[model samples]
Structure formats: structure tokens, C-alpha cells
Target chain A: MFSASVGLSRNWEPFDAGEEIVINTLEKLEGEPKFFLLFPTIHFEKNNGFQKLLDGVFSQLNRSTPLLGCSVAGFINPKGCYTRGVTSLAIADPDMQVTIALGKNAKKTPQKAAEEFANMIKKEKSKNNSGVLFLILPGSTLPKDIFHRTRRISNPLLSSLFDKFFPLYLALSKEGVAKESEFIDKLYSRISEKMIGISAWDNNLGFSNYQFFGNRVLQNSAVGLYLSFSGEITIKYATPLKIFSEKLRVTKKDNSNYLINEINGLNAPDLFFKELKLEKKYLTEELLRKITLGFPISAYCGNIFFNRVIGLYSDKFLGLTTALNTPEIYISTASGSSIINSFDKVTDGGEKTNFVFGVSCAVLLEEVGSKIFEVKNILEKKQIKNFLFLFGGSEHFMTEVTPISSQESSVTTFF
Target chain B: MSEETMLSVLEDLLKEEDVLAIMLARKNEISVSPPPDKFKLKNPSIFSLLQSTMNEFFVVIEKFSSQGLDKIYFELGEYELMFFLIGGDTALVSIIPALANKGLLEVEMENARLKIRELIQKGV
Candidate 1:
């Protein structure tokens, strides 16, 4: 039998929060958990706090249990949405087996890291076992070297000029994300099977996000959990996007296909504005945020279309969060009602299961705000008693034909 | 407002760059802005293809009328075609370069569709 319990601690102190989470979880879990998943907010990472939190957790449970997780923007549980504190999911099953793997230097050498991560899992799992891969990696594309260099510019005038041309820096940062996508592609090619997970994120979209492997805190790395269960596993996903514009061809793009330079013989931004009937003069930071939240570019890949949220743009280019493999794309928008309604749609039609692991895009959580409680209500209506939902920067899932990385909400239920 | 005024409104859309042609079909009547000869020499088969496609599109519009479908867009060879339904029996079609300012053109077409709808409602 499969049993799962979620533990949440809102204590301000990191060590106390960790202890409370373990005590809270162990009180209801009945037995020693085989696997433990941690989803802590960035708040605990201050002043070596993550290590202290992990110490507290280890103080309570066996140090050998497979534990893997990452810092999140926030998370949702039956209790409600929380932006601060640590939440954990502990699972105990007699027929389920899990193996943990870690690949370092994900940003610098993605292909090598992917090989290490995949090779570890492949060597550990038995040949006849049907395994599911859960991955968490650093999601930020902000180039640390450039950012530190820019910070060292002491001249006021030079700093102001750099600020004025910030979009260029943003475009450069997007190249890292393109590399990460390539890394994911490599992982998919090596481990061609079911996969579902998210990328680590922080509250402010900063570079403070960290992944947890057992008692250690890691950055710029990929962590995986290979689970082979003898029972049924159901995966449900929802990304209700409405297509608004007709198909537009990508006439030109950067080498990585992450930075689009031209579309339909016009500058990427120019074509985007023209299609939306907006003027260039009215563009502002606020307007850009609204545009990114409302209108995301949807590119067709394999047999499905995946969304690529616009993260950076200038007069000459449009930087997307994910790589675009196809030349054809359509402008799409998501409404608040549609996002909320997706909860019901995703939770529906699946066999009734008590244990569920959900991952949603942090941007969507920020967009929906307090309306996220409706998701908890939907889960309650579906009779899901114990579940853990995390909000990360990006969500990943494997389609029938290929792997897809996009801004989506998904739930993986094990019965 | 008469058909001449409606045609003039569509002519304004041609002011934008790369807009090849505009066609307005109302029941048994048809109107093409900039005349057919201007672009007929450049691409002679465009008009015939538009005529045949519009007939089949009208049939589709009738079938999906209950769903309140108002717009249809598709790419044909090197050009893009956008068809907007004006009232029950009238359709406004614009043919433009594949890379034209589609967003701005959409707004312009909506304005033109509204103007033509008012004219048709007035028994022009």
C-alpha cells in the first residue's frame, strides 16, 4: 500500500521549522518513510539556514532515507498557499523502490551533467522496473559573471548607461536557459520514459534558489529521484491557453533558437507589437510585465504545442524562456478564470487517489494570487486527502512523443 | 454610406506596407480595392483562388454560425489571407504579404469591418 503525508511548518526560525516539519510529518505518517521530498521557500536559505534546517530534519529521521527537493517560490497544501516556511512530503510504501542521483555543474556542462545523472539512475534501477524520473535544477538564466562585473562599474554615468541597456544583458542571460533546455533534451534522449518535475525558483526571481540532496545544499546542479512502483501511477496536466493570433514564421533567430531576431521580415518586437495593435512608444516595464503574463508565444513541437513565456525583449529581439525548435508560432493568452478552472479539469477524470505530487509554474501562482485557494478547494472536492503542490519557475513533463518544458501545472498521483 | 464609401474605407487599409489587396463580398455583389489589374499581372491566380476559397469558407461560416465565429485566417503559398464575417451574408477578406504587421492589420480590419457593417445595416 502507498501512503503519503505532508508536513508544513510556518515557524520563523529555520531550525525550528525543520524540526516542526519532521515531528508534524512523523506524527501522522505511522512508519518510517522510504522517501522524503522537501519544498522550502528561499527564506530559510539566509545565513546558512538551509544546512541548519536539514540538520534538524536529519535529527528526527534516518539519515539514509532518500531525500531530494529544491527551494521554491512558494507551495500549496491542504492548509493553504504559503510564501514562507518549509513543507515536506514523506512517503512510505512496501512495493515502491527509489534511487537518488545528483549531477553537478548543470549550467556550465549540461550534457556531461545529464550523462552523469542518467547513468546513475540507469545503473541503479533493475531492467524490468518501470521507473519515473523526478528532476529539479537551478532555473535562473542570469549570468553571474556578467552581473558581478556590471555591479563593479563604479561610475554613475556608466552604471546609468548599463541600466538603460539592460535588455541586452537579459538577452545574454537567456542563452543560459537555452543551454538548460538542451540539457533537458539530452536527459530525455538518454532516459526515454516517463518524467515529471520542476526547476528551482525563489520568491524574487533571484539567484538564491538551491536544491537539497539528503543533508547537503547544492546550486547549479540537477537532482533526480528514480521511483519504480508496483502499483498504478496517473499523471494529469493543465495549461489552458487561448490562441489569439494567426501563425507567424520565425524568419531569423539566434544560434540557440532562444533569441528570436526576426519574424515575418520584421524585427521580432516590431512584429509582436504590430500583431497586437500596440505602439512602441507606450512600452514600459509595467506594460512588458503585463504582456509577458498575458501573451506568451506558443510554438508547435513534435505533435504538441508548448508555451514559451517572453522573458526579455528589445526593438531587435525577443528572448523566450524556452528554446523554440519550430519556425511557426502563435500568440496565446491565459485568463484568470481559465487558470483557476484548470484545477478542476486536471483533477477530474483521474482515478481517485490519496497521494498526489503537484508542480505548478511560479508565474502562474503570482498571476492568480490568492485565487490559488480555489485549487485547494478543487482538490478537496475531488476527495484528495493528502497532496503536496509546489510552485517553481518552470514545469516539465513528457508527452507521448517527446519531452516538453513549459509554464504548466501538473499532478502525478500514485495509488 | 454606399458601396463607394465602404470601398474607400478599405482603401485606407492599403496605405499600410505589403497589403496586397482587399475584397468585400456581400450576397451577390463583390468589390475589390485598387482594382484587379494592379496585382493581377503580378499574381494572376490569386483572385481565382480567393473566389473559390471564399465560397467554401462561407459554407463553413454557415455551419459554425451557431458558435458565433467571426474570423478566419490561414496562409496560402507566399501570402496570408484573413476573412472577417460582416453580418450574416457579408464577408471581408484581405490579402497581405506573409510578414505584414498582422497585429496592426487585425485592428485595422476590425475597424473596417465595423464601418462596413454599419453601412450594410443602413441598406447601402
Candidate 2:
């Protein structure tokens, strides 16, 4: 009852690429799709004309079909994770009931905005309880608003730090009563009992160019899409980081994601370098990658080790790719071999999936470097018919019960 | 790492017998020390509700301080909540029991803040 096609095209010309992708996708689909999900790389979004081009191509394809899109850091098609291009999935299913609500204004609390959007969907379609919903928002980070009232600092270094740290804080604050996760919890609390689904973070993928379009809403809004299927849908996440160090607690932290004031009782950067047995004097890009591979921060929930990666480092702090407010954290690491093993583990069950959607960490590609293609080839070998991978700075996949984000993992939704 | 030292400090502070729960907030977040499930607050939802409202308060305060504001206090019946702006965006929040000595708790909170600041200043 449900069928979809994945399309990807890399014409640097944004307008031409948009039309070409749509045409190629339509060729592969059996009939007109009721919904189309667009995922374009951050570079594609940087071209100011991309949005108009998207509107033109999307409307031309089918005015009746609703279009939902977000800027992505990177996206995946059958070919694997590509740094550039547009990747999309078109879905046409008569049994699925769909409803969408949008929340505008970047300054509003993400939690409140999501709640309003979810409430609207719930109010309109309270009768249907069997489907899933996808909450799509612009990528987590945005360029620091120098003009904003909160950021009036005049010093360029301080301004740059504030700009970078503020958005990262919003993205990485997951545990406790934090910004990003708080919004997620509020939204989830509103509709978790009635429906099942996940929230997708789309920004210029990893670039700060965050935008989302759906219904009457444009950029700077949280868009909630409600989907009810006559058939069943199963969802699960794949966490790839393996813990390598003993558990330690986050004793202190600053408001920004870039700086950890303290971990355990020692200064964070000191403890980080000390534990790795690496000298600060010899720090290099290769060493940084190796350290990132070996020392991801993992939070213990029940018995599971939920991991977060530190991609950026300075004398001040260790930058967390995934948000955390939990007091306890452990050192975690990922390797090319381990990631491949995780891919095999996730896909080995043979679920006879009609479609498998992958959301992977951009850090994995950074750490693995050119070896990403090897992992891609492994994914390609999967017996499952259709699989698309999306690579971003961070990846979030959630069900009603367990919602988490990771830097070295892949969360795949099987349909 | 330094978890032991900080936990010991928190342990010493909690030994005051009147401190029921201690929490930390950075920006719009509130994290209960000893974890919420273990320490158990009477109404956790109240903290979340207030956190959202306090965000507005922060927005207004930003207009006054280019460097950001430092420290705020609140009294609700028998409870006390102390908020300290540390490391710019981070807030060190502490909740004290009604029967505890307010003056003593404030001093302890300052001590913890100073130690945290020292750790940050001595970055690797």
C-alpha cells in the first residue's frame, strides 16, 4: 500500500538541479506521490535562489502534493553519503492520513512552538491513532545574530565565541531541563500517547543556513507532519560509538557547548588530554581526529551508553556534537571497523523493509575520511531494496520512549 | 577525573541535613544534582514550567549587562532557589530546604562556584 522513490542530482546550478531531481524521481515513481520530503546539502541552501527554485520545482511537480524540506549538512541516496546534491523521497499511499502544522519565529521557545504545532495536528485529527509523525525543524545551528539583543558583545573574539557557542548550546543541550531536549520533550509529551514517530533536525545540514518549508510556513518554524497508515511502521536507532574509558561525571560546565568548565574535578581539556596520554605541544589534525575517535562522551541510561562526539577542541573546552546535561559521562570512541560492524549489526536482521532511511553523523565521515565509501559499499550490499543515508553534524532518531542524538552513529527508520 | 572531588564537595554540602535537593541550570536548562530519579523533587514539572518563564527574565536582564547578569534568588514558602551565572552561559543553581540556614547555604554555593571558576581558569 506504500511505495516511495529516492532521487539525487548534483548540478551546481540550484534551479536546474531542483527540476532535474524532480523529473528523475517522477520517472521512478509508479504514480503521483501525496508527499515529498526534500533534503538538500547546506551548500545548496547557501545559494539564496535555492528556495525560489525549490518552490518552482515543487509546485510544478504537483500543486496538490504537500512538500516538506530542510537544509541538510549532507544527504544519502543509493550511491551513499555525498557532501553535495539534493536527496529526496516521494511517498504515495492511500492508506496514510497526513496532517501538518507549522510554528514560525526563531526567537520563540522551540518547546512551546512544537507544542502549538502538535496541538494543532491533534485537534484536527484526534480520530486517527495508528500512524507516525515527523517533526522537522531547521538545522540546530544558525549564524550568530550580531544584532540580536542577547548578543551585543563588541569584541570580535568574544562575539565569534558567543555566536558559535550559543547555537551549539541549543543543539547540544539534551539532558536535564535544557533548550533542545526540553522542546523535544514538550512536543513528544503532547502526542506520544496518540501517535508514533521521530523528529528530524534539518539545517543547512551542518552549515548555519537553516530553513524549512511546508504548508504556509517558510524558514524559522517548527513543522510537524502527522502521518497515519493503515499498515504498521517500526522504528529503531543504531548507536555506533563504543565506550572505551571509565565513567566520569560532568562536574561543571559553561552555557556554551564549546567549553566544559570541568569534568570530574579537573579542568575538562586537561582531563581530556591527560586521559588520552597525548601531549598538548604535539597536537595536529591527525591527532585531533584520533582523539575524537577515542574520547566521545557517553551518558549512561539504564545500561545503555548513549554517546556524543567532541569534534572541535581548543585550550578552553571540548566541543560536544550531541547535547548533554546529565552529570555522568564516559569516554567513548569509534573506528572505521567498529562503524562497519555497527552497520552490519543494524541491517542483519533481514526485516524485509520496503524502505530504510539512514541518518548518519558527519563526524563519522570526518573521522573515517575517505573510508566512508567502504561503509557506504557495505550499506549498498544490504539485501533491503531501498536505503538512503543522510550525513549531518549530528543525527537524531527517536520513538516516543527513547529519543537520543549521536555523532558517531546511524539511526535508520525502516518502512 | 575530578568527579570525586566535586561529588565530595556536594556531599559535604548536602550533609547540612536541611538541603533536600540541589540543581544546576545553564541558560534555559535545569539539572538536578544526584540526578532527579534518585534525589526526587516533589514536583519536577514546576521547575520546567518556571524555566521557560525565567528565560524571558534572562532576555530582559541581557539589556542591562553586556557581560551577562550574575546570581538571582527566589523564595517559595519553605524552599530557596539560587541561580549563579558562571562561565558566561552556564548557571550554577542550588535549591535549599526551608529549615536550612539560608546564609550558610549561600556561602557554600559561593565556595562551589569559586572552585568551578578556578577549574575553568586553569584550562589545559
**iRMSD, all candidates:** 16.4, 23.7
Which runs of model 2 end up more than 4 angstroms from their true locations? A79-81, A106-108, A142-179, A193-207, A215-220, A255-259, A289-294, A311-316, B1-124
RMSD of 1: 19.0
* Cα lDDT over the full model 2: 0.59
> At residue A225, what lDDT does model 1 achieve?
90
Model 1: per-residue lDDT, tens digit, B53-111? 66666777777866897777887766788888875567888887654435335644765
TM-score of chain B of each: 0.84, 0.66
DockQ of each: 0.01, 0.01
Residue pairs with backbone overlap in model 1:
A274-B103, A274-B104, A275-B103
Q: Write the per-residue lDDT of candidate 2 for residues B3-116, one digit (tens) a residue.
A: 455555455445433455554444565433554454435766645655556567566556545655667778765566777666545556666644333432453465566666
User: What is residue A264's positional error in candidate 2, in angstroms?
Assistant: 1.8
Could you give candidate 1's per-residue lDDT for residues A107-143 as a string of tens digits?
6677888999989988887667676778887776555
